[model samples]
Target: MLLLGAATVSAAGQTPEAPKQAPTFRSGLDVIAVDVQVIDRSGAPVAGLGPEKFTVTINGRPRRVLSAELVESRSATSMTAVERAAATAGPPVVPTLPRVVFIAIDCLSFDASASRHVIDSARAFIDRLPPTDEVGLFAYPYGPKINPTTDHAAVSRNLATVVGQRHVPLTQFHLRPAEIVDLSAASSSANARDSSLLESVVVRECGDTPDDTCRRGLMLEITGAALYYEGQGNAGLGMLRSLLEQLTGITGRKTLVLLSAGMIASDTPGGRPDISELGMQVGKEAARSNTSVYTLFLDTTTTDKFQAQVRGADKNLQAVGRDSEILGRWLDQFSGEAGGAVFRVQVGSGEYAFNRILNEISAYYLLGVEPGEEDRDGRTHEIKVKTKEKNVVLRGRRWVMVPKRGAAAAGTVSPAPGPAESASAAPPAPPRRVVPADIQAMADAFDRGAAEFQRGLAGTRDLANLLRNFRGSETPWPNAPRRTAVFALELAVAALRSDNQNARDEGGRLLAEYNVRLRQPGDADAFECAWLWTEVTALEGLFMPDSAMLLVPAAIERCPREARLHLAHAIISEQRWLRGTAGAAEVPGILERYQAAVTFSETAAEARMRAAWFLFRAGRLDEALALVETRPPSGTDPYVLYLTDLVRGQILRGRGRFDEAAKAYRDALATWPNAQSARVALMTLLLSRGDRQEAAKLAAAVETAPADQFDPWWTYWLGDYRAYSSIVAKLREMTQ
Candidate 1:
C-alpha cells in the first residue's frame, strides 16, 4: 500500500531541450559506475566539477574513463535520464543497478520543530519526480512499509501521512516481556515493560522533532504478535522475511530511507539488558538479504566507548553521537563488502536527518553491460567497478563470482593462481573461464526434496523419530563430518518449496519436531536440528522450482577442510529449548543455528547470509534487514537478497514513502521478476498512481510471472492495510 512517485516519463519529441540523441559509448568497451563524496582533504562533498576533472583506478592501476557524470540531489531529470538510459544499455557494457539507501531518524532526542522539518524534507523528496528509481522508507518500532513500481502522486500522499504520524505509539512503544492477555496485564506487568517507555514518551511523543509513526498510530493502533520473551528468539523476523521475499523479488535495486531512534533494545529491571542479542539477530538477517543499509543518525547517543566520529559537512551524522559508531559498524560490515558507503549525519548537527536521507535516496551512478557469461551453479560473483577518476570514490560490487557452489569455491586462486603463482602472479582467471560447474545436482535435489516434502515425509511417529534420529547429538551422518541437522533441514526446505503434500506436511512436521527439541534447551546440542530446519525451510522459498536439498547440506557445512567437524552445532543449550512444539521445531532450530554462527561476522558474505537466514525465520525483520544489508555480496544472494528487498520495500511503502517502496519492489523484480508479491506491489503502485498502462503491464506480469518459492505466502504479503493506506494517501498528495 506504500505510495510511489508516478511522474510521467519524459516522452520522445517533447522538448527541444532534450538531448538530440543519447551520448553514444564505443562498442567492445567496458563501463563502470562510480559514486563520489568529492571534497578537499577536509572531506566535504565537492560539487561543480565536470567529467574531465576525474581519474579512475583499480588495484592501484590507472584506467580509461568510459563515462563520467555527477548527480546533484533532487535532480530528478538527470536521475530519470540516467536510469532510462541504463535500462536500455546493451552489449559489452551492461547497466548497473542503483545502490541501496538507509536513513535514520532520532525521535528519542529531537524537539518538535526539528522533527517537523525532517518530515517536510521527506515530503519534498517524494514530491520530486523521477523514472526507473528504487527506494524504501522505514520508521522504527512500527515495522517498515513498502510499495512497488510507482509514480510521484502516490509518494506525495504517503509523505503527508508520514508527516502527520510522527509521535504516535507506532513510532515508539512500551516494550513488554510478552503479550498481555488483558487490560489488567498492562497495568500489572510493570517491571516486565521497558522502563525506557517513559523516556520514549517524553522525548519522542511530546518533545520530538518529528513523530511520523506515532502520529499515524493515534487512531489506528497497531495490533499483531507482541515480540518479547527469550522464546521469540529475535523479534518477529519471519513476518519480515515473508514480506521481504516478495519485495526483494520486485526491485532489482533498493534504497532504504529509514528514520529510527536507535532503540533496538530490551531493558530488564535490575538485570543486564540483552540488546546485544537483539543486535546480533538484527545484524544476521540484514546481512542475508543483500539489502544495502545507509543511516542518517539523528539525535541518538551511544554509551559504548566503541564510538568514532568523523566531522560531517551536511550535518548528517551530528546528533547521531556514538550510535553512528555501532550503526556504522553494521553498515560497513555488510555494505562495505560490496564497496558501498555508510553515510551519516554530521558529528553534532541538527539539520534534520531527512534532508541528507533524501539526498542519498535520490543519488546514484548509472552504467550497464550484458553479462559476458552465464554460470548455472548459482554462483554469486563479487563485482568491482572502476572509473577514470583521481581520488574519486566509487560505490559498487567488488567482484561477482556466482558459481555452482557458494562464493568460497569460486576464484580460489587468490594469493596464488591455480597450482603455481605468486602475489604478483597472473590474472585470477581468464574472463572466458568465469563460468564454473553447472550445479545441476544441487538444483535437482532441491526440486525433488521440495516435491517429496510437499507430498509428506513418513507413515508414523516412529518414522518421524527415525528421520529425527538420522543425525544424533554425537553422530555425523552420511557425507557430513559433523551435525547433519543443517544438511537435513536444507533438503527439507527444498522440498517445501513445491506444492506437494510431502513438502507441506512432512517437511513441516520435521520443522515442528526440531522446534520442540531446540526451542528452549535440553542437552547442549538439542538446538542443532531445529536451527537447520529453519534455514532449510526458508531456502525452499528462495530456490523456487529448483530443489535446494542438494545444495542445502553443503551450504550448511561449507567450511575449510581444516575446520572443526562440529561447526554446525547449535549454540543454544538443550536444557533451555528442549520442550517446544515438535511440528514447528525448525523455527527454534534455526535461531540456535543463527546464534551459533554469530562469529561468522568474521567470515564471508555467504556465512552472513546463512546467519541472516536464521534471523529472518526467527521473525526479526528490522534486525534481519540490518544484517542482510551487511554481507559482502556478489550481485544479489538470490532468495535472501530478493526477500530482503521485498520486505524492505513493503516496510517503506507502509511508512508512506510510496515512491521509495515502489522503487524497492521494482528493483526486486528486476532480479526476480517472477515474485508475485513484488508484482502485486508494483501493480498496486501503478494503479494507485493512475498510470493505467504501467499498472496493466505490472498486473499482466503478475498473471504471467513464473512460480517461486514464496508463492505460498502471497496472501499474507498483501494483507496488511497499512500498505494500502500509504498508497492512498500518497496518491492523493502527488495528484494534487
Candidate 2:
C-alpha cells in the first residue's frame, strides 16, 4: 500500500496577476500539484518516474495526471558520473523554481546541551543543500528571525545564539502517588474532575498539616505555573502560524523543520485548550500555505548520575516520567497531523535522524492532477495516489487546499475567514518608510533619555549628557528647527521636575533659539509646526499646565487647518480646567476645538470617540451618548470601534443603566478579545450584582490569558505615543 502525503502545486511558467474582485466557485479547471516520495525496499530514493506510471484520485474519484517530474538535489560528493549522465538524459529540468525551507528553533523547550546538539545537526543539513535553495530561521518564544535567503553563513551565525535559553520547569511541588493516579484515571473531557485534582495538589503541597496562609501561598505558585505553560504554548502556535502566512505569497513547495525538546500539551485543566483542536487549526493553515511541518524531537533527559540521584531523592521520578510521556505523544500527534513525520533524536543519534529527514525532502516527484468542478469550492480536500510500479513505497501529504475557481486562475491562496481575520477586519496603517542614519541615531538617543526619565534617573547631569549629542557638530536635517525645539522641551520638563535651576535655564535658552528659528519664513512646514505644537502641549500638561495655556492659541494660528493641533489644544484646555489652573470661562473654547477637530479630520471615527470621552469625563452624559449613538460603518478601524464601545459602556454605567453597559462591554470584547479593559469592567459589574460565580470565572480566564495581549486603554491618555516612532520615521523619510 502506498502511504501518499498530498500537496498542491501551481503550474510552471505561469505568473497570474491578483484578482480584482471576489472569486467565484467552479469557473474553470485547476491543476493541483502533489509531492510524492518513492523509496525502494532498501530505503533508497526511486528516480525516473513518468506520468503514465502513477494514478491519482480526489474524494475517491479517479483523475487524469497532466505531468510527472522527478525533483532531486544532492551534494557534489554524493553523485557519480553515471548518475549525472542519467539525470541529464531526461527532459530539460525546471529551472525557474527553487526550494524554500525554514528552520524554527523552539528555544523555550530545549536545554543547553540539547540545544547545542540540535544546532550541530542543523548546520550539517544546511551544508548538504545546493546553493540555489533558500533558507530561513525562526527562534520560538520571542527570539530572532531571518527571512529566506541563500546565505548559509548568516544562518549559522544565528544558530549560535540559541543556546542556554530554555525554560526550567517548576520543581517546588511534587505530586504524590494518589494525586497522579487520580489525574490519570480522570477522563480527558471531565473538566470539573481536573479542576478538583489541581486544588487537591495545592492542598497537599501546602504543608504536612495545612493552614489558610500556607494554602494561599501554594495556590498562587501553582496558578503562576499554569499561566506560564499556557502562555508559552499559545505564543509558539501564534509564531508558527505567522511564519506560514508570510510564506503564502512565495511560489513552489516549502518546508519548515522545527527543532525542540517538547511542548506542554496540557499540564492543568482550564489553562489551555486540548492539543487535537490546536493541531487541526495548524494543519489547515499549513495546507492553505502549501507548507509541511517536520519536527526534530530532541531528548532532554540527563545522563549525569548526580542529577538523576537528586531527582530520585526528591521523589519526583514518577512525575518526570509522566511528563516525558505526555510531551512525546504531543510531538507525534502534532507533526503527523500537519502532513509531516517526526524523527526522534536520542543521545548521539542527532545526525542520523537529520540525515533521514534530509533524504526524504531532498528528492520527490511533483505530480499534477486535475480536479472536478465541485472540488474547487475553496476548501481543503483529502486525496489518494497509487503507483503501478511494484516494490516501492509512497509518502506525502494527505490533503490539499483547493482555491476558488477565479483564485486558481490568479495563482494565489484565498484565506478562509477565521477569528484573526474578524479581529483585524479594518484597513491596516501605511508601512513605515526607511529612515536616514542621522535621524535614527537621534531617535535612539531620545528613547534612551525617555527610559531614564521613566526610571527616576533623569537628573540635571543626565539631561545635559543626553542633550550634548544633539548640541554640536551634527549637520541639521530639513526640519531641524522643530526637531531641536521638541528635544529642548523634553529636557526643560526633566529639569523642572528635578528643581535644577542651572539646567532649566540652559534648556530655556536652547528652546528660545529654536523657537525663533521655527517662526521664521520657510524654516518649517505646516506638518512640522503642528507636530512641535502637539509635543509641547503634551509635555506642559503633564509638568506645567500654565505654559500650555499661553502657547496653544499661537500654535493654532500658525496651523489653522491642522486637525491634530486642534485636538491637542482641546485636550490641554480640558486638563487645565480640571486642575483648576484655568477657569470655567475656557470650557466653551475647549468644546469648540473638539468640534472643529472632529469636523476637519479624515479619521472622524477616532476623533468622535475622543470627543465622546471628553464629554463623558465632564459629566455631560446626554452629549456623550449622542456622540457615540451613530454606529461606525462596516470595515471601519477596529481600534476606533473598540474605544467607542468602551467609552459608551462607561457612560451608560454611570447613568445607572446596568444592562446596557454590560452589552456594550461585550461588544467591545467581540471586536478585540485580547484587550483587558472591557473584560475587567464586565467582571466588576458581575461582582456588584451578586454574581460571584461568574465573576470568579472571568477573573480566572483573565489571569491565564497571554501576557502580551494589548490593551489600548493604557495609551489612550498619552498623545500619539503609540504611533510616535513611525511618525518620526516618516518625518526622516520626507527630509532625506
RMSD to true structure for each model, in Å: 28.1, 24.6
Tens digit of per-residue lDDT, candidate 1, span 475-547: 2332332233343444344345446643443344344333322222123232343343334335332422112
Clashes of each: 187, 5
Q: Which ten residues in a row have the lowest lDDT in candidate 1?
A: 219-228
Worst 10 residues of 2 by lDDT: 1-10
Model 2 Cα lDDT, one tens digit per residue, 1-736: 0011011111222343332222222223456667677766544666667778899887788887766666554532344667545544663223224578889887767667657867888888887776767889987654658888889788877877766355433233453222333333342245533566655654556545655544443343333333334334544554566566676655666788888777656544433223445555665566556676788887654342135223432235665565555555556666655667777776455787677767666666767677777878877777778888799877666667667765643223122233355335642232222454443455556545555433443322455444433332232332464455455455544544555544543343334334333443323465557556545544443544344443455566666766666777676666656555444456677788778778874556777787788788778988988888776777877877888889989888988998999889999999889589999999999899888998898899899989888888876765554565455445434333
Global CA lDDT of candidate 2, please? 0.60
TM-score of each: 0.33, 0.47
Candidate whose lDDT is highest? 2
- lDDT score at residue 581, model 1, on the 0-100 scale: 12
Question: lDDT values of the candidates?
Answer: 0.37, 0.60
The per-residue C-alpha lDDT of model 2 at residue 52 equals 86
Residue runs of model 2 more than 4 Å from their true location after superposition = 1-30, 40-43, 51-55, 60-62, 75-78, 81-96, 169-171, 175-224, 267-273, 302-322, 347-349, 386-393, 409-736
